[model samples]
Target: MTCTIFYSTEMPNEQAKVTGGIPTKPMRWAVDYVVKTPDGRTVVQGEKTIQRATFEELRAVMNHTIGEIGDEVGNEATFVSWRATAHGGKKKNRKGGKRK
Candidate 1:
């Protein structure tokens, strides 16, 4: 069996503006991932939030995730591809709306 892995980093976002709200810290970086079989069937997927947003943390999480995938798919499974990306950070304004 062959599989594909997709993962990415979740960027932090600033605190939102709200009335009578206590200021809270911005979100930390997180990793989101997905594993799929050759037939485009989703095997496993999840997101993990980490304290740090470094490459080392990302690598560690990825390795752990892959191991979990292996356990789920068995030893015959071969990774056919990998896709990674980064998401979040700044919120974009909606169309025809005022820019912050």
Candidate 2:
């Protein structure tokens, strides 16, 4: 069935600037998604965690994912919402508290 998907991209750690030097590690991202119909029926949902060496590469990944989902679900499926947020340097525990 036709549906809309809401998704968000997140960087779990602080990003450093690309100064006049090369980095030794890549950046990671967590992309979470939820697909639901107009009447609130969930069709599909999942998260994809990926690492990239550059911002351009990250955009490429997101675009590819959106394109593939569109192709699979046909024109009726649309990504109506998208956001990019970052997490602080703290990991949460299962109880929703900050981990030490």
Candidate 3:
């Protein structure tokens, strides 16, 4: 069976401090995922949160979710397509101009 997945990551406002001269906020990654069949039928969908916003952690969550979906579907589901997006802080202005 072929399935498509859509996922997005959002950073919460909660923060933690680390040992460093510069102040940094501890980011928590919240992932929302949806699994759909070929006919646009949603098989499963839910949200998961990771304490640390690292690539490895995110990947692990995604993999585990997909596995769960496959088991629930009762078939070998192949990932035909997927989409991902990240929502976070605003981008800094890079234009070199005098402040108004």
Candidate 4:
């Protein structure tokens, strides 16, 4: 089985760090990940706080999580088509209808 992981986050701004009044740090980023089928539809996803001190440990944790989900699903799910049409896009009428 294969999986892809994507990460995204917003860093705290200097202004907030200095001027904002908070009892603690503004934010912390845990490792957020998504698991998808072979053709790109999401199967399972989750986030876990950075607990391990090394890269290998973190990778092992993520792999184990994904493996558990895979085992439960029995690896029979098919990939879903992810194509989407544009919203409010213009299209010509084949019947020669009038345009507003």
Best by lDDT: 3
Is 2 or 4 the stronger prediction by TM-score?
Answer: 2
Which of the predicted structures, 2 or 4, would earn the higher lDDT when compared with the native? 2
Question: RMSD to native for every prediction?
Answer: 13.4, 12.4, 12.5, 18.9
Model 2 CA lDDT for position 62 = 63
Q: For model 4, how does the per-residue alpha-carbon lDDT over 64-99 read when each residue is reduced to its tens digit?
A: 765676676676434211111111223458786887
Judging by TM-score, tell me the better candidate of 1 and 4. Answer: 1
Model 2 per-residue lDDT tens digits across residues 1-100? 1112224323234232232222233455555655544455555576777664344565567677766765666635533233222222323366957665
Q: lDDT of each prediction vs. the true structure? A: 0.46, 0.46, 0.48, 0.39
Task: Kindly provide the TM-score of model 1 when superposed on the true structure, using C-alpha atoms.
Answer: 0.43
TM-score of each: 0.43, 0.48, 0.47, 0.39
Q: Any runs in candidate 4 off by more than 4 Å, and if so which?
A: 1-29, 38-41, 76-100
Pairing residues by index, what is the TM-score of model 3?
0.47
Task: Pick the TM-score winner.
Answer: 2
As a whole number from 0 to 100, the lDDT of residue 86 in candidate 2 is 28
Cα RMSD for predicted model 2: 12.4
Per-residue CA lDDT of candidate 3, range 65-88, in tens?
777787787744433223333344
User: What is the C-alpha local distance difference test score of candidate 3?
Assistant: 0.48
Off by over 4 Å in 2: 1-25, 37-40, 82-100
Error of 1 at 17 (Å): 33
What value does the lDDT take at residue 7 in candidate 2?
40
Q: In lDDT terms, how accurate is model 1?
A: 0.46
Q: With candidate 2 superimposed using the best TM-score fit, by how many Å does residue 100's alpha carbon deviate from the native?
A: 25
